[model samples]
Target: MFDHIQIKVKDLKSSKRFYTAALAPLGFTVQYEGGGAVGFGPKGAPALWLGEGDSRGSVHIAFAAKDRAAVKAFHAAAVPAGGKDNGAPGLRPDYHANYYAAFVKDPDGNNVEAVCHKEQ
Candidate 1:
């Protein structure tokens, strides 16, 4: 429903590093980078944009994973890249039978997540 989302972070370089690794497993790449801003998404679409600045507040952004394995990979990549674990990867029946996901807080404390909706 949304074309793109922009997030303000205290440090662009650090945020870029964190997100570059965090989103890789989900198949997102740094599509554009210049002028203190970086955009990430699939090949031609930069749906998530990160700009250098002071954030007004933390935000939660979730990316769709191809499968359960991708969700696990995102969690693994995030931690070493400077993310704090918010939730481990597993099935959350509360959300749905196949709502497998993981959550991590980025360097700026934004809740980043990867989720797969299909049953394995």
Candidate 2:
């Protein structure tokens, strides 16, 4: 429904590092960069973008994972790379019977999440 989403961050380098590691587990990588902005997603499509600027309001971005393990790995990699834990890997029965997700706040306080919707 969206072509891409952009976030304004306080530090470009730190944001880049955080996203690079966090999104890696979900198969997203830095696909393009310039003008103090970095784009990430599949090799041919840019879905999430980060740019240098004042931190904006908190935004939630969720990536679909192949399975529960990927959600765990995303949390593992994101925290050390400057992400703060918002929600640990677990089933959110409130959202759905099998909605397994992990949430983390980026350096700029953006809510990033990875989710898997398969029974486990």
Candidate 3:
């Protein structure tokens, strides 16, 4: 298991705004903000970290949703917050029978996903 993951962005403020809106539905919030970096996750944990700088390359980060509805909510919330739709919410039988999820490209063009591994 990973303790945390960090990504670099061109603009901290803009990326912060995007993530603030995008991750809300999945129950993640800004956990810490200091040293020109922002941390997001549950109340006290920071699973994802964003720092201001040039992003060398894109990365895919999938967040676990409690259920299918939460996955849908994450997609709905992410789009208007500056995310581009990559994959609509649905089952990926290839990945698995119950791989219900959605994907969006973040401001930095990173693949962000919200997935529920359980059948609804």
Best-fitting candidate, measured by lDDT? Answer: 1
Model 1: lDDT to the true structure: 0.96
User: Which is better, 2 or 3, measured by TM-score?
Assistant: 3
Residue-wise C-alpha lDDT for candidate 1, range 24-105, written one tens digit per residue: 9999999999999999999999999999998999999989999999999999999999999999999999988999999999
Per residue, candidate 3 scores C-alpha lDDT tens digits across 52-100 of: 9989999999999999999888899889988899999999999999999
Model 2 earns a TM-score of 0.97
Candidate 2 positional error at 109, Å: 0.8
For model 1, the stretches where C-alpha displacement exceeds 4 angstroms are none
lDDT of 2 by residue, 48-80 (tens): 988889764888889999999999999999999
Ranking by TM-score: 1, 3, 2
TM-score of each: 0.98, 0.97, 0.97
Error of 1 at 29 (Å): 0.5
lDDT of each: 0.96, 0.94, 0.94
| TM-score, candidate number 3 | 0.97
What's each prediction's clash count? 0, 0, 0
Off by over 4 Å in 3: none
